[model samples]
Target: MTNWTRKALLLSVSAAAVAGTLTAAGAPVAHGRPAEPIAPPLAWGPCEPIPGTPVPAGQQCATLRVPLDYRVPGGPGVDLAVTRLRTDRPEARRGTLLVLAGGPGGSGVRRVAQKGGALRAATDGAYDLVGLDPRGVGGSTRANCALPEADRHVVTLRSWPAADGSITENTERSRRTAASCARNGGPVLGSFSSRNQARDIDRLRAALGERKLSVWGHSYGSYVAAVYAQEHPNRVDRLVLDSTGDPDPTRVGYGWMANVGPAVALRFPDFAAWAADPAREAEGLRLARRAEDVEPLFLALARELDREPRESEVPGVPLTGNLLRQALHSSLDSDAGFAPLARLIRSAQDPRGRPALPPGLAGAIPDEDASVMMAVICNDVRWPGPDSGYAGRVAADRARYPLTAGLPANIAPCAFWKYDREPKPVRITDEGPSNVLMVQSLRDPATPLAGALRMRAALGDRARMVTVGQGGHGMYLGNGNACGDRTVSTFLVTGKRPARDSHCPN
Candidate 1:
């Protein structure tokens, strides 16, 4: 699986800016003040519509006030941005299910709005759908490092190297970017870590009057769910982890990025098959007569771009090797993205044609999103202190997984990040409730089968996994086989986990 897929598979949330101590010392304390009890009837207010959004009917928005530091509930507080779709079938209602979005920075409110229907349908309307914008995201308390727009651009922020594959530019950029965030991003920025997100989820759970939560966590959200399950096992009723991560505390963000190479290599064949099909000729994008030939052609084309970029649809933004690779990386996550990639490839090779671009490359991730992503990863763990170490790993990865080149193993802003890890990483264990049900794709490029196996083993007997014999991430009702969907839905509605790990054939 590709690293992004794995990270995506783990949950929608990425393991970026996760720092702080999950120590006993850090636990919420009352000091001299009594704790505020969670009450019924949530304080209702008008939700600030998401920028470029249309509010759905019956969806209510509100602010959830939580302790800034769980230990000092009375000292200072923060507001959690939240949205809810109350149970459509109140007569059949079970309780509330929270949608934990991935990306320590991703907005849960948006995810719930987008995916709430699917989740409700999947559960047969057993629960209400709730999503929250984690701290530092939209509608919640926000923060920014206010760095130059150039440095803040997505491509630069991700540490994508220069066209020639040199790390000097990436290294320097990482250092400068880290320095800027440290200088400008303040205390609020420090609070945007994973541990706090878990705390916030718990706070929301308490606020909602739900004794237990049935959770649907995507990408980075899976990690958050796993940690929540570990911390408050009794508070969980049913759990679904989509597109999971390695969850290896030792590696954290760096290890997550390093896996990208193999992830791309694994998912590339699916794209190759689609591009080489006879049906694709009408699109003017077919690259090979046979599927095996696609990787070599892509590699050659990337190398050629490395030597010389071609004019792209985006003015001044030449289609360089890294850009092509990143596009391929993004596109391969779903079958829907195949056409744009093929069109781009065809445009690049076509003397008179233009390759189309994916939206991610069309523009940078918004500044707020970028800042949150950068902050959480750097804050979550301390990266290797030296550039040489990254260089060595990059060279080694390039040899082992040439499809992604050395991009996965390359230096990121975290390498030169300002803060050291303040908390020990949460080790996901099987001690959580057996209510967890994991759904995964067999041929997923992002969160590969091998990594999911580790998650399965870790959760041992405490969970059951349904393996969809298909490609892409988020197997449950998402680019997955019917059998897989049925398996997850059955477990979610009936609380009947599979007796053992099972497979769903395409």
Candidate 2:
């Protein structure tokens, strides 16, 4: 997940009074409900933009009240922070387009602020771009596990095995984390599941007074969008699932996590090629003279660090093998991250040089951010119990995929998470309208092309996937692939899709 600064918005008065009745399946109950299904009107005003992201001139913000628990719609509520940028050319406007952010903890309000202008221009002002901070995200009602500072660090939170591939410490951390969340997070944290996020989007839809919403969901958001499309088939207009993963209901987030080791193996060659390029020598960033040599060099450095960690710019935090491994995993997400990663590797190799850790690796994340990231994954489905042979799996995975060092198959907090009350994950099927489109990169470190094929197959004829001959996590307005970007933009603006599944050569 990208590091994002939190920006809190003021809660509106609409939250004080319940406005709609929702069923367990997220649909509005009609006959038996005392109140109509209509959502309360939003009170739009200026947005309190995130530090680095400026809200566009016409962008407006509002507060939306959704149920704290869908099963008890009339009980306590949580406020979602929403943002909208209406089209400048209203005459040519197609409809409202919702932009869903990734991470399960990603801030959609910030996403709209960062990408709204480019998206507006890309579609030729065809859509009123809109986004929201799902519960426990930035600007929305939050839940905290009050976890220890060490446990909140990205490397630790990811449950990376020790240098020796022993998961003893990882297991302890996972159990403690699960206990802390259950003790402190209460119902708000438990409600941070994908299905609840989908329900929140539908609430946002009703609040906007739009009969149907066109969606652009990225990463984890793609799964939430798929769940929404499955639950409310008739309410979707056009859907775009970007950088999606396998929608296997039984596994859900666990499946995504398990695929990461192999995905990194698939994507590492791209970084290796870039690091070995002749042009990088002029920039003083070349890691190896040949592409194949880069892997051994990295593995050797990591093993050395495991034996003797190097001091880093962050005073208390030394650069260890697992930290280096985690950094590599993150750096593989984009080409822009290559140079910094190469520089860190060079610094680590120097006996007297101190490496400057990437911001994400340098410090512990916010409690709220860590809380949502853990909650969503753990709440969505059941993971193997504590005695389910995680150490053996880690050993096998580490031998099979050294780049990730068995981190993907390692024990997570979900293993200790209480699953007695959690609902089964929603299955993504081909039952929805054929308006769905998936844009995927051939080599995505987080969500590989192979997993994307699973999503495409599950959607069957209901979806058409555009496989870009690129390597990264996100596509369409990202990665600067003109062909892929144009295809998504054209589909959004004119509703024209490719004749069938197609590929865009790099």
Total clashes for model 1:
41
lDDT of 2 by residue, 190-285 (tens): 778778888788888889988889999988888788888887787789999999888888887788888988888999999999999999999998
Clashes of each: 41, 0
Best by TM-score: 2
Give the per-residue lDDT digits (tens) of candidate 1, residues 259-369: 667777777888889888999787677889999999889889988888888777776667778778777776766788788887788788876655555555655555555
Error of 1 at 131 (Å): 0.6
TM-score of each: 0.91, 0.94
Candidate 2 residue pairs in clash (backbone atoms < 3 Å): none
The C-alpha RMSD of each candidate to the native structure, in angstroms, is 4.8, 5.6
